[model samples]
Target: LAKTTQPISMDSYEGQEVNITCSHNNIATNDYITWYQQFPSQGPRFIIQGYKTKVTNEVASLFIPADRKSSTLSLPRVSLSDTAVYYCLVGERGQGGYNKLIFGAGTRLAVHP
Candidate 1:
């Protein structure tokens, strides 16, 4: 299993883009990088997932290098409502659910007006 590390906090203003990066030094061949976001009093929600290279969705984009040692979650034109605690996780999905998923301390993103 790979240990992940991320910044303790970040600050951004509305309409600006924010990129939170996580580093996983020992990522395994089968391990996949996933990002989650949690709002006040709400469970963490899925944001994006990637193995290598780049993956994009309606909400955000995830970029992974060929080495697969790190990943960046790019939020475009963030808004105040997007303020939340972002979690970077690494694991694989099993028949039951996510297996052996290791979560980091998380990055608290403060979106200013």
Candidate 2:
């Protein structure tokens, strides 16, 4: 498992674009970067996943550089409702004899009016 480093907290106003970067210096070659968002009193929800280059979805975009040492999660025009704790996770693609996935403390994002 790769160790993830991310901001403890971030502040932003409504309708602003927010980019959160996570660094995993020990990331493995077969590991994939995955982001999840968790709102107050709710379980973490999957946001995006990527191996390399860039991947975009209706919710967010993930940018992984060639080295795959770090990844960025971009949220477009974020609103107050988007305020949540975002987690950066790295894990193997297949079962590969690994039965559990580990998550970090998470990045707390506060969106204001």
Candidate 3:
């Protein structure tokens, strides 16, 4: 599993674009990058996933460099409701052919009025 590091917290005003970056120094070739968002008292919700290059959906966009050692989650025009902890994860196969995703402490985004 690759170790990921992200900012502990970030501040954004409403209607502003916010970007959170994560670094994984030991990423592997077969690993897929995934991002999740979790609100208070709720489970983490899938935001985006990518292998390389950029991927975008209605909710957010994910960018992965060619080296696969880093990724960024970009949220456009965030609102106060979008405030949450964003997780960056890497998926790999564990022992016994089981797939596993490892998560670290996520970056907390505070969307202000």
Candidate 4:
């Protein structure tokens, strides 16, 4: 498994965009970097993923440098509803396809009025 480091908290007001970056210095060969978003009292939901380069979806864009050591998640036109803790996880976590070794301590995101 690869260890990850991310901000403990972030502050954002309404109508602004937020981008969070996570680093995994010792990322494994078979592992991939994935990002998740969580609202208060709710489980984290998948946002985007990438092994290298750029990946975009309805919610956010994932930018991974060629080094494959770190990645950034970009959320566009963020709203109060979008203000929430974001997490970056490496390794299978079972890939939602197998048994998972659960690890939790998700960052807290505060959305100011």
Top-lDDT structure, candidate number:
2
- Per-residue accuracy of model 1 over 1-110 as CA lDDT, tens digit each: 77899999999999999999999989888888999999999989999989899999999999999998899999999999999999998877665764777667799999
C-alpha RMSD of each candidate structure in angstroms = 1.3, 1.2, 1.8, 2.4
Tens digits of per-residue lDDT for model 3, 5-113:
9999999999999999999989888888889999999999999989899999999999998888899999999999999999999876456797677778899999999
Tens-place lDDT per residue, model 2, 42-91, is: 99998899999999999999999999999999999999999999999998
| Candidate 4 backbone collisions, by pair | none
Cα lDDT tens digits, model 4, 2-91, are 778888878877767777888889887767788888887987788887888999999999998988788888888777788778888887
Could you give me the TM-score of model 2 versus the true structure? 0.95
Give the range of the ten consecutive residues with the poorest summed lDDT in model 2: 93-102
Off by over 4 Å in 2: 96-99
Q: Write down the worst ten-residue block by lDDT for model 3.
A: 92-101
TM-scores vs. true structure, each candidate: 0.94, 0.95, 0.93, 0.85
Q: Give the clashing pairs for model 1.
A: none
